[model samples]
Target chain A: MIDRTMTPLLEVRNLQTHFFTDQGIIRAVNGISYDLHEGETLGIVGESGCGKSISAFSILRLIPNPPGKIVNGEVIFEGTDLLQLSDREMCAVRGNKIAMIFQEPMTSLNPVLTIGHQVMEPMVLHQKIGKKQAIQESIQLLSKVQLSEPEARMNSFPHQLSGGMRQRVMIAMGMSCKPKLIIADEPTTALDVTIQAQLLELMKGLTRDIGTALILITHNLGIVARYADRVLVMYAGRIVEKATAKKLYSSPSHPYTIGLLASVPRLDQDLKKSLSPIEGQPPDLLNLPKGCAFHPRCRYRIPKCFTQSPELEQISDNHEKACWVDVH
Target chain B: MKSFIINRIAYALLILFFVTILVFSLARLLPGDPIQAAAMFNADLSNQEIVSELRARYGLDKPIYIQYVIWLKDFIQGDWGTSLGSGEDVLEMFFRRLPITLELFAGSVFWSLIIGLPLGVISAVKRNSWLDAILTTTSIFGVSIPVFWEGIILIYLFAVIFPILPPSGYVPFAESPIDNILSVILPTFVMGTHGAGLFARYVRSSLLEVLGQDYIRTARAKGLREKSILLVHAAKPAMIPVVTIIGLAWGYVVSGSFLVEYMFAIPGLGRMGVDAVFARDFPVIQATLVMVTVNILLVNLAVDLLYGYLDPRVRVRGNLGQ
Candidate 1:
């Protein structure tokens, strides 16, 4: 549905994803929802196994079957529900319209093919172009990603490239179609800090130039601060907080968000003091705690908070947070 | 790459040394006296004189080390001595059978790749479907049947029922390549089917695993069609293991698949080794065994190097034996 002034390019409403493992049914993404407007970066931040990546997989339907399932959701890109589309139709939408950059680069590339062929494949298949045209486009994409000697690199296999270069190739492929929404799930998590910064900056610049909506999913607060326009902080498969980058950094309401920000080593803080990591482990998705999932790990866990799960209540005109302990 | 070649050559010499000495000693020690072989080998010498000459000529009376050293030096330079049965040079005799063995090896390798790789990929991509079931059943039959038994059955059908396809014989490929191919097809098929069946299953499983990877996911997310994703992204990486198996099987086909040669009446190295053992021609048998070992070893070395070449991560620095 269209907003009054700015229609969101992608709107995921009441998404519920589950994993039926031997242990039990894990509610991976429990009733999470978000909106991405045109040319906006929506960053989903959470610790490992907190459904940040799972939610992105749900958008692409890349979740492996017989284990993971998107039980309920409407991934409305434009007006079409991606879940409802047939396999063929979904494929057309996948690279042509909505692209995703995965976490690992080494395992992501095909070992047997030249880098040129890997990039060219999507162009030829989706675009229905000739081999020459496909190759030309591939070279152009490689050059755009700053790969030197495009023709030579084209003949070289994935094994020939460095990790950073491979991630850049992944980014290049994601940008190949100039999709309306590019879901980059921990794209730079595997890279070194310096390369990570370079890739993030490149991605930001590229997306801005093309007006491509980005769903930047990660656990890094610094990355969120630098790249994201809005932030969704997930904990135990639910969005605990949602706000603009400025507001989320200044005044995070949820206790999990508060603990996470506190845990990060601040450059401004005393170097002599040891970092205080949050006291408890993340609540198991399979067997969650009663009432609020964060209760056992919280310092301000009220008795009533243990009896009821909190819904996302609007805290400000452009910010919302899910917590029983509301900021006055 | 240069280091790889040098390493292979050095190790190959060691392999030749041990294998030749083993075949030579074992052939000499077998129940029938090698004295009789020596006597049979010499037409001019008297029986008593032949026995004395044999001890001196073979250096059998001397320490085993002395015998091994004399043999190893000549063996390195392609001098396998002379055959007791034919009086032909062991090198020449081995070469005569080589054409046949190589032809069979080439045919089997070609057919296995042509059949196995595609079938395996199809089964994996269409896993659990009717086609997969059919391929699974067919490949199971292919693998379960022994090459010898399968060879005989094939002859019975093609040779007897059809009254056509020549059931047995060895013709040089150079003499008539077409005739050689035709004569050898049945034996090659029987042998190739085993590898084809094994490779197909490996390929399918390997492919499915690669297809499941996140890189493959990235390929699909590229909006490339399914064909390109399967061919370019999923197919090649999945094939690393399959290539490995095929490469290893080249060794097996060169050495282990002797029964195929026996059934088909081909004069390959396997057949020559068997014939040499029966005749108690120690030199011929030892020479053939060494040649087979060298061929198989070189094949394995090449494959190892190929693995490194294909994937940048796998570096073949030296030949460390298990």
Candidate 2:
């Protein structure tokens, strides 16, 4: 239900991130572009090392320097290019306009600091509110995340809490500033199955309630189907496919996307039928295959796929695929 | 918390008991006999009968276990006995020199923390920079250099060449604060340089490790200023290991750096302990050993309590009686 005519909440144009290691340059997130509408939930799906996390990191410019750098990109959030902003100006945008929830919730929160202080920090920093007011807001945020005993829990350190509770605290912290957009990078990957469902539902509900746009990075296609409005399937360092969640699930275009769907075990399918996992390992970023990064692993690769990379081309309304061969 | 403290105290007492026994045995095991050494100073004590009589008087003629029991009994009742060499009360001499040793220990700890902590933090924050290289190299030199040599070099530079501070000596702080400070500066500096190096290395590594933690990224993602992130969020966790190092170092200094004390000619417990060893003064040696052992034990206890205060994980475990 994205209005194509409306201005996008976030627009990432030709973003590229590379790592300069002693061995060689690692092209982590190759040139990629995407747009997110206001209040939309976009899921970036990929196996490990596909640069889904790196892509999200690039949008926020959180890539660690020395080894990692966003070489080229325009992360236009709310019509302003974030990459061009000064460090001071950038600080204002982070956690204020765009907040992020990290993968490891247990280690994401400071071990020594109390939960209240951590949750209250962004509010005090961005909102310029008093500690007394920040504390009250923090308690409310904790409660909103469905954490029990929010008032008493405020004084407790992170180690005292379970992984699920810590993730809830992280959610509370992410929502503390009432940011315009939230990037949850595999937020529930570390939790139990039930907890993951509950947390994601809570996150989707909360973000939707607040009319905040979300970009959920995960390898779970089922999660994307359940929560995301739009989906981007990444392979190697590039997005191999992008489409609406329903359209992508019902009619996946790219060979990599097709393979990914086949790999995941479907409850509706017969139990005796085995999953068909994609063949071969992800290409080394230092020395990728001299064509499409996914070509070597793509079962539907043609001669042209071996010689040349395929650019993301539109096939129909709201559906794009980067592949030489037509899967369907 | 109460149980944890009580548990630690019980452990400390057991350690103290073993220390007393060890010191008593080692003092007896020394090459020279206290009575014979006393006899050398007094011509009348050349008589064999007189030597035996003196040994009997000091209860040295009794079996080792009985002697230990008698000494322990007297020690517990506040009777430390007279020094074999000086004939002065062991406790009296200890009390008289305790203040000077404590002052030196305090001065060294203060200077080391002041010099080491900031340097270490700066080194880690500016890692791979020219400043980090220089600070790291300087700390290496601090750690490697001998304390006695450092003391002498400091004396030659500040005392002999510049004549800014006194070369060696102890002046009661009550007599003149300025002179007292000037007199101890070189000794404290010599002692603290090593500790400063150790602390700098520990803090740099610890802080660097902490900076790489996920929470640090979370802090950055939270829009916190770099200063607040480094000082507030990262510093406390980093200081946990540093606190343990500081505690062990404090115990070492409190026990007295004998070489530093001797080279500086300071009338401190370290000097007394060395002199007592050479003269085989059993009472003074025993008393000094007891004092040092207790100081180390107490510092260790404080460190454990501090661990509980700094790390909630430890505190929670303590509460759970784990």
The TM-score leader among the candidates is: 2
Off by over 4 Å in 1: A1-4, A128-162, A267-276, A302-307, B17-23, B37-82, B87-92, B126-144, B152-182, B312-322
Candidate 1 per-residue lDDT, tens place, A116-211, comes to: 777876667678899998888888888888887887888877777889999998888888878888999899989999999989999998988888
DockQ for all models: 0.50, 0.76
Local accuracy of candidate 2 as per-residue lDDT tens digits, A212-313: 999999999999999999999998889999999999999999988998899999999998999999898878878899888888888787888878999999
Q: What's the true lDDT of residue A319 in model 1?
A: 88
Cα shift from native, residue A244, model 2 (Å):
1.3
Model 1: colliding residue pairs: A95-B223, A108-B215
Instruction: Tell me the tens digit of each residue's lDDT in model 2 across B25-130.
Output: 9999998789888777789998999889988988889999999999999998989999988889988989999888888888888888999999999999999899
Candidate 2 ranges beyond 4 A from true positions: B254-256, B319-322
- Give the best candidate by lDDT: 2
